[model samples]
Target: MAPAITTLAAAPELSAANTGFMLICSALVMLMTPALAFFYGGMVRVKSTLNMLMMSFISLGIVTILWVLYGFSLAFGADSGSIIGWSSDYVGLSGIGVTELWDGYTIPVYVFAVFQLMFAILTPALISGALADRVKFTAWALFIALWVTVVYFPVAHWVWGSGGWLFEMGVIDFAGGTAVHINAGAAALGVILVIGKRVGFKKDPMRPHSLPLVMLGAGLLWFGWFGFNAGSWLGNDDGVGAVMFVNTQVATAAAMLAWLAYEKIRHGSFTTLGAASGAVAGLVAITPAGGSVSPLGAIAVGAIAGLVCAMAVGLKYKFGYDDSLDVIGVHLVGGVIGSLLVGFFATGGVQSDAKGLFYGGGLEQLGKQAIGVFAVLAYSLVASAILALIIDKTMGMRVSEDDEVSGIDQVEHAETAYDFSGAGGGASSRSTAAPAPAVTETKKVDA
Candidate 1:
């Protein structure tokens, strides 16, 4: 999250208004993880539903503990070599006074710490979507612990910390296009590469089990994102946060419409799934660019991200990867689009003076944005792959194929997301289809 830049020659006192607003925002961000769980859970087959939810839910637990221990210090503490940060005082959150304000801001250090903890919680959860229907729970949990320490903490430092290289270089990431989305996206790619595809891969009919649940999750994400975007500025003392709030709404709306339009043209139907995915794409794209772009610029960012991500979700099919729920397509691609577009659409009025190509800023900001984008991407991809490999070599990563085909929820959790055993032979228990005749000829089919 971006802190308000200040030039006051005096010590800043706490403001009840900003602190209350930040607390509410922190709560909002905290809700996004469970929102993500519902979104991902509804997309998988019934047998794997609980497992998908747990993957996202587990991060809230693993990351929170780590963040309290050293994740916060490593991410937001005093910088070292522009690569990482650390402070003995921040360990266990021990030394800071309760009333002490975060540097240059009106909110308390504790408020800022919890607010940032929510972001830390959500970032690793974003990777779970790509590993759906596979991955051992214990292995996945271990991976979150290690990946956040190695990949997320350092990348967050690079993008937002006091002495971070990208921060010093003036690479503008208003929130977490690079640090959160791209970082998680690339890590998803890396881990998926190591774990390989699901057992069925492209063979099974893996459509979402509950579109309504997906829609509900998407709706919650859109609601929570206001805080995710606006609260980055830490306060409403200036109108930049307000501008971010507006940009968030407009961009998300534009993305939904654009994605539906693309779906209608490309697939001849406007699916609810398209609308939900599109809205999320817009949310992802506008995240980093919201503070820098106008509502109109946000529309462009959202629309482009919507159309591009609409097409991108199909890449796993063509490229022979099993990105079970399109995390790489929406988060990775959307993050890059929003980040790069900042180099073109930044108005130089809201966040910083560094303009984009469209504002006659030339290639300077664009070049800087590229460095930030690829730097995070490369490091996360490589580092995450290594972490997953280490876990795979030790405790193993994937469940047995038999367990996977049967169901991960029962195999791993010993429970299921739904139970129809007491339904008195409900529709789910009754067979509705006619028995198929014996096959007479082999036929080639494309899906």
Candidate 2:
């Protein structure tokens, strides 16, 4: 009999290598939340850029606090109803010993907890892009706090936690295709519906204020995703981890090319925005399939995602939802493309007991994959809408017309993303247009 194409090595009692590797991966994943801030920040108008960044940044602060308090317990604790888990022992991470391994893994429980915390932070941030330029900062903060509690905590349990019903049912979300992307994407759509469209909607020329920032954020997310996907194996120097890493790159490259090609054909220009957005689409699509599909299969997943997501972004125009930065188009749609295709493209050789329809595995995996995808999308959409409505009725969701028109960053954050006031060198004299105080120039826009 042939050996498995991807095989994970049995972990030793305490390999400093694996633990340290996970630690680094955890840090890398942490950086992605801020990188996302830059990405989303650059996409909005200059007036609201700081507000866009704060939306993503606040998630890191809020989710981190909640995760340690009760989020982790509810997400990873011993199963209760196959729906959610709750155990006071795990709450506040009280019972987890310092030297103890996390169940069958080689890393400390804290490493896994922190790593997943990064995910919880990034998921709601992903939703922020959809509701940009309109939401009240206080309302957004309150919404995310409620969101992680009601929506994110339980969804993570269902997909990743021990004894999760999806796990029991054989659904394969190698690393948060359903839990993160689909979950967040659906939630983005739901909240957008409740908050309504940005004031200008289709009439305004809302191009990205800084394409280079978006590109940089895309690069960081691409870099950190290696840890997000390969690290899910929980150990490296293994065949499965290597395969996942390889597939991740290939899929991203393929998706980027496909997206650019589509843009050139349809829009007559291959834009930097398209390239950056394509890379994210590829990353999101391959995330769930990387562990189970071959490198060739990864290309297929990426290419399909690039093309489909490129088209999906237009759904908002036809449907008339705001989706300022196309979160639903890219994440929700890209995640579904990746998750459902896994059932058709999964290979047993690459991953034991994992074979899709094309490999003679039948429709069992496909059926299961669909169930997981729709279930997450449905739950997130409904729950998020309810949360948004409750917040809208009570504290109010949208900023005042004056705040939205005058600028959300100035009103909410008391800051502007740029201060052109210091453009008084040989390149330019002190122009009257430069008003805000110039603090510093942190990054150069190559794009």
lDDT of 2 by residue, 263-373 (tens): 999999999999999999999999898888888899999999999999999988998988999999999999999999999899988655779999889999999999999
- Candidate 2 residues lying further than 4 Å off, grouped into runs, are 1-12, 426-447
Candidate 1 lDDT score relative to the true structure: 0.93
Candidate 1 ranges beyond 4 A from true positions:
1-8, 424-447
Candidate models: Cα lDDT each: 0.93, 0.91
The stretch of ten residues in a row with the least summed lDDT in candidate 1 is 424-433
True-structure lDDT of candidate 2? 0.91
Candidate 2: residue 105 Cα off by (Å): 1.5
